[model samples]
Target: MENTLQLDLNRSSHSCREDFSEYVAHLQLHMALQARNLVPNLTQAADSREQLLQETQAEFEKLVSRQMR
Candidate 1:
């Protein structure tokens, strides 16, 4: 009876490990897909940010020039 219990515990542990590994694999796949979708949007946002910064910098320089004049 004791040996049977030990065998059962080992089997249960192995199954749990397998389930955890599968879950992790699925989670990673989901994250990779999500990241793939997000990359283009992130790139566009970065470009927009750069454009805004350039515009703001140009305006600031104009204001500074006016003040100096």
Candidate 2:
């Protein structure tokens, strides 16, 4: 029973990682589109976008850590 529970936990972690990867891909594509559209103000756009991205990444890391636990 304990071993089966551990196996389930491992599988759930892998699935979480897979889902997280897909989510990251979608987020990156959206960011790229926003960057493209902000071409006229590329410098400010890039800065703002990078800040947003960092926040998102931090959150994602926390979420992944929780799933691993």
TM-score of each: 0.57, 0.52
Candidate 1: which stretches are off by over 4 Å? 41-69
Report the lDDT tens digits of candidate 2 across residue range 1-69.
Answer: 999999999999999999998887677666655654653422333577776766665575565555444
- CA RMSD of all predictions: 17.9, 8.9
Best by lDDT: 2
Global lDDT of model 1: 0.63
List the pairs of residues colliding in candidate 1: none
For candidate 1, lDDT tens digit of each residue in 1-69?
A: 999999999999999998997777666656555644543332233577766755665565465445433
Give candidate 2 misplaced runs (Cα > 4 Å).
40-69
- Deviation from native of the Cα of residue 23 in model 1, angstroms: 0.3
Best by TM-score: 1
